[model samples]
Target chain A: MNGYLLAGTITGVVVGLVIAAVAMTFTKKNRKEKFTYDERQKTARGEGYKYAFFTLVIYNAAYGIIDMSLTKPWTENMTGMMIGVCLAILVHVVYCIWHECYFSMNEEPVKVLAFFGIISVINVIIAVIQGLHGELIENGMLTNNCANLIVAVMFGVILFALAVKGYVKKEAAEEEE
Target chain B: MKNLKLKAARAAMDLSQQELAGRVGVSRQTINAIEKGDYNPTINLCIAICRVLGKTLDELFWEE
Candidate 1:
């Protein structure tokens, strides 16, 4: 890599870390009003965690086996690990959403949904830019640039699930009325 | 079996599931699940519901 590019990357990462730290501090300050899950929701969340853990274990095992058996790995280490983590997160989110335990007492669903929407859009844009640059794949193998694409897809799936669940509930409510 | 007694009690109080759940510090979905026989809440939650609805354990949650 060019020396100037390496320096610029390092500088950008450092600035990003500072911004993230500031955001965390602001969030912590605003979170003084704590929201808690009720018993049933807590139990459902626990089950979600269990399922997510199992997903992570199963995904990692399969990924490891595939990587070892293949002559060339499809993904780099960071990307492969991120895929597993995202899968686990997707499972957990879907389970919690299905069980109606995803949102706590004081949390606004619209805000959470908007947050996910923004994250999905940002990731999708980054992935698209990388794809256009021919960075998402190299030598017939998936590159680390695909990580953003995977994240975009994960959030997209979550948004889709939430929408579907909301639609189902609306239909059920209309039927009951 | 569905806890029709709990549903009746909640209804008698003129409280919607959302209102009752708010009073009992739970989600409406939890109350709906309990009423629908889909979820068996903990004893604490049952007690909370009973207290909110002015019912006893035997009145609301006990199997007939």
Candidate 2:
């Protein structure tokens, strides 16, 4: 309703649009027109999802207990948003590790891990900036709600970039065979 | 330095990087990186390559 909220909303939407555009461009450039999931990739993804789900449940339970002890409710929007994004990132990291381990047995794992590390640092910087500017929360419940939205967008963008790079390398190898 | 010896050996066996990768259960880029000396393969991958090429590990991996 206020000017700050309006500005945060606009910023979040713009960031989301830019990230979506970039993802589309990468997918178009690298992948085949048809979509196909390799059996190995599927199995790895399934395993990763399982890890992510367990992580989310455990984190939520622990955080909920802590919040309750502090006289805070677990149903708050800000806490929910943080938990959701953290779980999403956990899932993605698990998937990346699985895919790399299965398909790139001879390749260094540090390369993919480094990429994720960089993205995480960037996300933290953004969150800190947004929080400092008071654009992320008011009264501890995400009055603006835009910073979390931007983080979700950025997560999707980074994941898409990783997928594109992986698929491109796979296609290049297939061509040589 | 480029791995001319590896490239030559692979050519002698009529194997592309993709074929070698398939035999070794790694991505082709891993094989390409090894051939270009951009990456060093693990001991397991080295042994796999030796097995596929029917050469001793030293013959396939050692630097002269």
Candidate 3:
């Protein structure tokens, strides 16, 4: 077993699950609220995104510089890509959780879960089909190990869309008025 | 910058932030934010809060 791939896969999946668990813990099933954004949540989320954005920018740049300057073949540290992405997400999660606005932003937690859950199932199906055809396994048990990271990217895009929608709701409302 | 007037109104009506938020079909945090003046509610939301608080928009939102 390749240690780098093992570590990379574990880092991505563990972080993704931790985020999911934390997000789900904030759901209010009985509250029956349609939209979760209020005044403060929108502000907090905006600020969180701002910080997360800059954090990732610097992180990615630093990672690239360090990877090229410090590593042997540049791909020697897959963690450059894998760990960097996870840490970007970690920054946003930590910021949101700190502000107590994580729950408010992830208003439709069930919808998010369902959407990603279906995609996850589909990824598995593709993996199985590819595995049967002898495609997914490049070396042995460590190839194509970034599946969780791929899912996380998709999930993050949808969540970003929701945040954008939430941020613009008031403006949209005013325009309609 | 808390909207003490709105808070006072809610208190006068013997309602908690959670109750008002529930009645307005919003989260308690929304109500809390509104009372704290940290978030500006939309006109629709302002109207909703007003309706729930038994006050006009001016009474609750307009700062005199």
Candidate 4:
């Protein structure tokens, strides 16, 4: 179990590093057309984080109460780690939705919401499966962690493709007009 | 379909999409999408674009 936990933590760190590297590379390559987050964008991002944090706190409290009532031997670290990962993911999703909806003038809320909803559902399903199988390791990894990561990457890719397609179609129409 | 006469007129003014977008206080990508008819700008944005290009709302955005 300890080995599993250590391995999971290492895997998570590696994944995080890879994602950071990719983002850094993209920003470096696109220096001329950098993505800017203005005051409004910052506010939106902050608000999303606030919402995620408050929800996570409430959820943790509820879960603690339930665990205590059931007299289940749950460790504080385990509960905190699980809740933290969930909150972090929720924050990311909320930030994406808020940025797409408010900051991007060309984006439609419906499309953004739909994409977020689909990704949230998929994540929930993965979480439930991991929970049922008791596959989540102490170090923040699961047996299906690879699947979760793949789904997350695919979600981003799909949204990017959709945005490109929408932008292209809109551009062509403007030319005709 | 909404007519993109405003974008066309802006193009006719020898203005690049980036230049027009700057004049209208929007991103170049927004202007490109608008010109490509991929996005529908808000009435305020439309008016701003029309004003920048010396055109009226009716002239730039009529529905077919």
Candidate 5:
């Protein structure tokens, strides 16, 4: 209905196509014993999913309890609350990717940084361009561009911190060996 | 069952973890985990490792 939905739909389609193509190509090749799933990766994936599921359950329960206490129906804004589920999925995906349990995506530090860096860059570019073009609602108690800027900065900081922590831990691990 | 014998056997054959993993069609982390006793590999993987190292199940996995 809006530009946001249109862009999201396009992005989703592109990503889905890429994923399907990769699956079709790799499934046959990987059917033979070619060193894919290892014990460590399997364990990591299991642990990641377990933790994510548990967290999601706790989150949903907390929200439900809060809704009951307030006597306000929570289903009125399902789209807003769905962000929690999206975040839970992000947590699981990040954990799996961190532990090298993801399908074919190596957990190289540079690659990880690059992936997050690209997201951050896109956010910043969009926000800045909107601001420069006078698209931001000026009365500013959190306009759309203002919100975009906040998200861009927040994710940028988080990504930077993750990259640093990963680098430090990797260095410490290498030093230990 | 840490399977040090498996590590030793692989080492005796002068194969790195990655190399042995390649031969057995598993990842190096799997080999490392098996050696470190952090993971219990399936029988199929055990057999594959044995075959690659020219070892038997009893020789590499059975603990005394």
Candidate 6:
């Protein structure tokens, strides 16, 4: 019921919407109007969804157990939930990227990569600002600001995986040639 | 169980994996995976590939 927490949530939602709009704009400009995944990519993405679903389920169960056992949990309920969501997203993204199914046939990966990079940078900046303001943690438990950091880390890991996979594919093609 | 027959047919047609994949509306990696035995595509895709190469299913996909 804290006014500051409500305000922070609103701000986060607004920022997220703005970033999504920007990403969509870039996608519209660079990609085909009809986005589609090939059959193999679709199959791979289905597996990714399965793994990500299990990840979220397991994370939520563990979080529930830990929260119940502790008198004071390390994060708010919403923040803990967000962490699980981020973990699921990371798993799905990494799996899809590894299997060469993350980007659809008509999707411009450069635009998607740029969007992720921008999101990571923005979340990191927000987390740092909140940390400086002594809002990242309160009473020895991580606050919602920690969720921003977790999201940044999630996107960062995705970006790194994408880069590494791209490099490996390029090297493989060269060797084959 | 690499699809050597498919690869041979594709090569005889002078088509790169990417070119064949495009004609079949799939990604190059999918074609590579098929030829490398890393992926077993669906019947629809197999038919599509066969149709593109002007080969029958038995010619490209049958294993003796």
Tens digit per residue, CA lDDT, model 6, A1-177: 499888978988898899877676676534446667898899999999999999999999999999999998888778888989989999999999999998877767888998899889988998889899998889988777687899889999999999999999999889977
Better of 1 and 3 by DockQ: 1
lDDT of candidate 1 over A1-177, digit per residue (tens): 567646755774586478556543433324665667888889999999999999999999999999999999998776788799989999999999988999887666876777678768988998999999998889988876686799889989999999999999999889977
Error of 6 at A42 (Å): 1.5
Q: How do the residues A1-177 of candidate 2 rate in per-residue lDDT, one tens digit apiece?
A: 578756866786687588656544444423444323333444556677777778777777877677679764534554465656666665666465435433233333345445444555676777777778886666655443555545545555566656676777779669856
Which candidate, 4 or 6, has the higher DockQ? 6
lDDT of 3 by residue, A1-177 (tens): 378767866886786688667545545454444336656666777888888788779988987786679534343244346556656666676566555466663365565556556656665665566667765444433245445444455455545655665556557557745
Count of clashing pairs, candidate 3: 0
The candidate that achieves the highest DockQ relative to the unseen native structure:
1
- On the 0 to 100 scale, the lDDT of residue A110 in model 4 is 55
Write model 5 residue lDDT over A109-140, tens digit each, in one string: 45445555665687689889988987554432
DockQ of 5: 0.46
Docking class of 1: high
Q: Pairs clashing in candidate 3?
A: none
- Stretches off by above 4 angstroms in model 5 are A1-36, A64-79, A97-100, A103-113, A127-177
Looking at model 6 chain B, which ten-residue stretch has the lowest summed lDDT? Answer: B21-30
Stretches of candidate 2 exceeding 4 Å from the true structure? A1-18, A27-35, A73-76, A101-128, A131-177, B1-13, B17-64
Of models 1 and 6, which has the larger DockQ? Answer: 1
**Model 4, TM vs. native:** 0.46
Task: Give the range of the ten consecutive residues with the poorest summed lDDT in model 3 chain A.
Answer: A71-80
Instruction: Please report the TM-score between candidate 3 and the true structure.
Output: 0.57
lDDT of 6 by residue, B1-64 (tens): 8889999999999999989988999988899999989999999999999899999999998899
RMSD vs true structure, all candidates: 3.4, 10.4, 11.8, 8.9, 5.8, 2.0
TM-score of each: 0.87, 0.46, 0.57, 0.46, 0.63, 0.91
Error of 2 at A160 (Å): 16
Report the lDDT tens digits of candidate 1 across residue range B1-64.
8889999999998999999998988888999999989999989989999888888999998896
Q: Score the docking of each candidate (DockQ).
A: 0.84, 0.10, 0.34, 0.10, 0.46, 0.80
Winner on DockQ (2 vs 3): 3
lDDT of all predictions, in order shown?
0.85, 0.62, 0.66, 0.60, 0.66, 0.89
